[model samples]
Target: MERQLIAALAALALVAGCASPQPAPVQLVDQQQYTKAMRDNSSTFTWPESRKPDLAVLAEKSGPGRDRAPSGSERIVLEITNSCACYLGWEDARKRGDQAAASQALKVMDEVLPKFSPEDPDGQRYARETAAKAKAGDGSQAADYVANNCDSVLWK
Candidate 1:
């Protein structure tokens, strides 16, 4: 009877282990939500007194900064390019006739693009594609592309 009881407990433990809960499903970024988040955090934007961009924080908030950042070339490509969706701000500013704001935002993107490197051909190609869109100040399209292709880290 004791042996049978031990066997039953072992089987129960195995069943319980297998029944562990799964992680939550990823909630992808939505443009309207991203827009609201950006606007809400606008006043808190600390772009630095020296006008230098916080590449690390940008990676964390917008791209793959820490654990998500893998060594493969494709990793940084997705990260910086994904953050390039910031170009959307520039696009919106231009539409409102705010040339000064647009110029500054564009300049910031320009400075950041060269910093995104990919050793592989595929990564390089992707980088170039992102760079072209950023140069054109296509923020809306960029955000859409990031949502579809990259990890869901945009508005987190």
Candidate 2:
């Protein structure tokens, strides 16, 4: 009876160990890795060399400045791009009729949209328009606008 009890405990311990949850896999992709992957993947966007300088400038100007935060237009452009990406992914999922994936993507966009500057008029306007459209179930149109106009609005 003693030996049987020990074996049962050992088996229970093994089962518990096997049932332990594991940490999620980490995804580490640096800029170089992203650039290389984008270059190799024809479907992915490869940012132009000419726009690198502008991107660098924007990166530099993004954080808090001496007087105030970056301009509303700048913040709007950034938020739009971010939301647009989410919407685009959602659009793809919607195209496949994957309601769960689409809903998840929209949830992500909803979380991000409110981060835009409410004080900035242009930013507020952009946010309102986007939110209205999203609420009206025009996510695909918003995604298309973002994918098509990112260069004009963002890079310029």
Task: Give a tens-digit lDDT track for model 2, residues 1-156.
Answer: 122322343344455556768633323333344333323432232222222223333333332222222122233334544555565666667788988876776666565555555545775566557656776778655665666645432342
For all predicted structures, in order, the TM-scores are 0.36, 0.40
Q: How well does candidate 1 match the true structure in TM-score terms?
A: 0.36
Q: What is the C-alpha RMSD of each candidate to the true structure, in Å?
A: 16.6, 20.1
C-alpha lDDT values of all predictions: 0.44, 0.46
Total residue pair clashes for candidate 1:
0
RMSD of candidate 1 to true structure, Å: 16.6
Write out the backbone clash pairs for model 1.
Answer: none
Report how far off residue 49 is in candidate 1 (Å): 13
List, residue by residue over 8-62, the lDDT tens digit for candidate 1: 4334445554676853333333333433333444433323222323333333344
Q: After superposition, how far is residue 119 of candidate 1 from its true place, in Å?
A: 2.9
